[model samples]
Target: MNQPESSKSLFLGGAAKATAASREKYVPRMGEESALEEVLVEDVAPVRISAFVGLLVAISSFTAAVAKPMLVLPVLAIALCLFALRKHDGRTKPVGTLAARIGLVLACLFGSTGFFVHHLKSRTLGNQAVYFARQYLELAARGEESLAIELQKTKPNRQVATMQLNEAYSQDESAMEQLENFRSGAYVDVKKAGLDTEWELDRRPRVFQKYGREKVDTYWRDPSGKFNGVIQVELEWSPAYEGEEADWHVSLFQVERELIVAPSVL
Candidate 1:
């Protein structure tokens, strides 16, 4: 049977009102819960990239002894550590404080060591070797053979030029023969080259420190007959006990030896 239109309209209106009331009661609670969750969530701070990189750089800087270019890494690592510290705040905490500190210490130690080694090898020891070699050769050129040989003797036998002038070694045939064998052909020519011919320093072909002594291979040349010869000189340094400065003594001397250029002197 067909029902009345008015009755059906009344039923549908009641159902719509019930649906609207249910939505109004539950929607506000869901929105409030979402807002509360958003407030409770915390923000995480990011790790500073530089701090980690600085640590790595500091460790690699140990190679500065062999690779001179890496010596500058200490300064870089220190700067990075400082910058990392500056950016730290209540909200953004630095993550790797321990690593940064360790990096700083290592960088300083290796950096200083590298510089000291370079100075000793390039300047202090090299100068001592050349100075002793020059004095020894000059004596040989002037016919002071016995004293020249004495200069090359080890620490105990070597004598200073000024102190030994008064007391001379007894001149004899054996001494002359020894001089002839030690410094006869090329050695004599090299010594005499310094006297008459104007010579130029060809190069310092090698510099080495081994077994508690410094050794240098130096070459010299002149326009007179194109004199080219290699001389090897060794010097030992004695710590200052009696004098203000370290006592440097010539430990060994040789002429016409091969000059080999090694990549790593250390």
Candidate 2:
């Protein structure tokens, strides 16, 4: 008896896709020679190396949040992904095409976030330190030694001000040494010159982390004023949770005592 046409296809038996060569494939009739030889053949496109590498670099773009120099990571990753996408030939499904696109997305996400944060934090933090340094000097100029010393301290350190500041300054040699550094040298000159001394930034503020704490240094120089020196105002970042910013406070007030006397000034 002849089999019905409904039961003829090789894959699904009925209405299933089958090649004309799908005669008696794996289960052939008594004397069938032609079988499903080409039924299981598959075509795969070559995977692009650059696309995969772009994905990796994109993942590393997260480091961009740590510093400005790391901004290049995401930029490079985006370039690679774009190049790989442009290389697509349309006809074939490029193996790494999806990976490249995903990489591009990740790079953009991390890179932009980091860029915004770096600039925002740097500017605000630097300005804060500069202002704090100026106020500290102003207090010193007014002979408020206790207040100046207090401003130079971290909040917690300043809170332990139970005893008289004069006695405390003499006792906490370590803290006193730092406070003394601020009270003398450039501090004295700036105070003698009055509070009108303009604060000139020596260079771009430097940001780094030490002892697991974020630190920023704002270097101030006033060569045109009686101070004629560079002083570094250091601020430390303290962590705050629940979407609040990390609080920053004075950690150190250091004056660069190196002297520079220009003939033009004299």
| Local accuracy of candidate 1 as per-residue lDDT tens digits, 1-266 | 88799989998999999987665533332244365322111233556677778888888888878655667887788777666556454454557776777777887888888877776666766666567666655665676666766655555555565765324443556555656676664556766665665544467636665664446655545556645555555566665655455666555555556669779876
Candidate 1 regions with alpha-carbon error over 4 angstroms: 1-94, 98-102, 105-117, 159-180, 191-194, 241-245, 257-266
As a TM-score, model 1 comes out at: 0.51
- Model 2: residues >4 Å from true position, as ranges? 1-44, 49-53, 56-76, 79-83, 86-91, 159-163, 167-184, 196-204, 222-224, 241-249, 257-266
**C-alpha RMSD of each candidate structure in angstroms:** 12.1, 12.8
Model 1, position 122, has a per-residue lDDT of 68
Give the per-residue lDDT of model 2 (tens digit) for 53-149: 9999999999999977899999999999998887544455778889999999999999999999998987776677667666665666677666666
lDDT of each: 0.63, 0.73
Model 2 scores a C-alpha lDDT of 0.73
